[model samples]
Target: MLSHLPTNHHLRPLYRLLALASGVYVLVFGIIGVVQTSGAETFDRSGDATALGLPTNPAFAYASVAVGALIVLSALIGRNLDFYVYSVVGLVFQIVGMLALAFLGTDVNYFNFSVATCVVSLVIGLALFTAGLYSRVGARADAH
Candidate 1:
């Protein structure tokens, strides 16, 4: 029972705009990640393995762009889109990223396991979870 399914609400436009912005943000970062690909580690900071000093592999760039593209698509096409689903996916990604960092922080994912990394993931996961869990859209039938 996601909100904003069938009708447009006052807040819908704002949410959609935010999604678009998020998409652009991630998309830009993704491109930057790909461009900074290098093997050697500098100050334990390897561009090939870390994007923005966050633990990442070559695949992370692609994933980020893909997520961004999805977000853009959803924002543009307002029909049959569930915002909650995307939020859940984001939440899940943060959780998985954290777990990976925890068990195999440095060696496994090549993540720095730095304070910044932990805080970033925590904030993202919490934000997504909070928004998704609290924001509810009435069923389509319930609208009219």
Candidate 2:
């Protein structure tokens, strides 16, 4: 998948910027998650206002931190769409989890899953998804 990354593209900078921005966003949010609610009686699934969805708390917070780390790491190593898959995976998870949180709700924990939470997740999912897909470098016209 990393066989051929475009040498140049107008959107490359924007792509990298988005990647970095999103990466930092999640990274910081995830850190806050673990630090803020580590020993709380219940989970805390709220934050990431930058679309941000910056979700967090306890076991879930650790999960976010891991995912956030991957996102940040990918921005460093993911020079192309192939590496951007990490971002895609993380965003998709947020989208799915938030959607479920919005509708079905979690019985496993009493986290406050509200409509706003769903919106945040969905927004972040779309944002990262867009960035990942947009960054894809296609085969060159002369690569045939």
Candidate 3:
């Protein structure tokens, strides 16, 4: 189904850079969240901890750090590995954002996500998806 997708796109470098920046942002945010919520329980849902203007708890913070690191590594090792990673991760983020939005004010909001976080997640997801779609590498004959 994706056979028509472009390869060796002119904007591939820009897309890759965007993905890298998103990874760094998530990583830094998670680190700050971990520090800010150090006193709280690992999965505590009662605290009002925040990082980079996004609501977070220890669990979410740690998860973010791991995900961010993965993205960073994938971007660094780009070759098509990044395309797959970014695509999958982007979809996951999009799902997470929607789920977070659905459970915004309820007890199921384990991530402590605010509207801003949801918005940012969606944006980042789209960015990553775009990068994945166009950042592919292949032989010159494959560019057709």
Candidate 4:
């Protein structure tokens, strides 16, 4: 069933670049978030902190930095390692986005995520998933 997915796709480089760009974007966002939320409570729910125009808190900002770094590292390491990294991160982003969306404006919004953040997360997740799908490498015999 998974045979339909392309391996060593012609546009793999482009997809990889997009994924890298996404990681960089997230990294920058997290850095700015950390700076913006400095001295604030780790899980502050004041709903007033924001970074790169998205709501955030210390905990979320730190997590973003870690996740972004992981993505960046995996993308740089390539050789199909990125494929697994992107796939897992993509799913994680999707799940986090949904959970944040569901908990918005409530006490459980641990990430202090706003609607914009949720949208961004979902978009990034999709981009990473697509990149992973086309970034696979196969033996010479399986090349198309």
Candidate 5:
């Protein structure tokens, strides 16, 4: 699958860089969540007013940290397809979790942000997946 990619060196580097950046962002967010949860900080529940409170559960924080670390490690190892799949799954989980929180009114503002981040991550994940497909197709064509 790796051999079918096009010879365009430009796309490869761009894809790698984007993946790396996304991974780093995820890792940072995850680490922050872990720290916040470990410290037992109270998440703010105010609606778009201030982010002084913590999320309802520290479990989400821990999960975020673990997922983020996995994303970063996957990207660094050039596992683009695996990264994309994992990211999409993670984003979906986040979206559902955020929606549930919103319905429960646990923290509307925080949930809103969570939804937004999930959407953004989903888009990035889709793009990465498409890029991987393109590379695979290109590689196959080259072998013909």
Candidate 6:
């Protein structure tokens, strides 16, 4: 279905760029998760054990691989408004998750870093979404 779609020349570049950025982010994060969870004995957050109940094992490695695959697929298949929508959703989730992590944090330094990263990610996501919207509008205008 994707192969048969006509090219919107104006939006194609923007879509590809966004897709690449998102895919890279996902892949990197997933890999980090895999490394962190692999044979990680230090349990800094005991709350995670109760809340997420994720076993510190090879399962996380598999999850990372799956995430990496999904990111690649999304980058390849995602285009048009779907890219913008998914980006927004991901940013929102990151913001909320970071806020929750901050609230649960005992250390000021960690909380500060988490909040800062969340803010930066949210800003970037908003900018990307705005660019996507503008690209679509510009394309429509040029077409008309």
Highest TM-score model number: 3
RMSD of 2: 5.0
Q: Candidate 1 on 107-138: residue-level lDDT in tens?
A: 55543345565565566455444434433455
Clashing pairs in 3: none
Candidate 3 has what TM-score? Answer: 0.96
- Give candidates' CA RMSD values in order: 4.7, 5.0, 1.0, 1.2, 5.8, 8.4
Candidate lDDT values, in order = 0.56, 0.58, 0.91, 0.91, 0.50, 0.47
Error of 5 at 84 (Å): 6.4
Q: Candidate 4 — which residues are off by over 4 angstroms?
A: none
Which ranges in model 3 have alpha carbons more than 4 Å from their true place? Answer: none
How many residue pairs clash (N, CA or C atoms closer than 3 angstroms) in each of the candidate models, in the order given?
Answer: 2, 3, 0, 0, 9, 0
Evaluated at residue 135, the lDDT of candidate 6 is 32
Per-residue lDDT of model 6, residues 1-144, tens digit only: 333333355665675566457656545655655565555433333323211222222343344356445545654665454455545545654564466456635653221224444454455455444433433322444445
lDDT of 3 by residue, 1-144 (tens): 567889999999999999999999999999999999998987777658889887889999999999999999999999899999999999999999899999989988878888999999999899888888988899999998
RMSD of 6: 8.4
Q: What is the lDDT of residue 35 in candidate 5?
A: 60
Show pairs that collide, candidate 2: 48-52, 48-53, 48-54
Q: List the residue pairs that clash in candidate 1.
A: 2-137, 3-137
TM-score of each: 0.63, 0.67, 0.96, 0.95, 0.54, 0.49
Worst 10 residues of 2 by lDDT: 47-56
Prediction 4 global C-alpha lDDT = 0.91
TM-score of 4: 0.95
Q: How many residue pairs of model 5 clash at the backbone?
A: 9
Worst lDDT window (10 residues) for model 4?
1-10
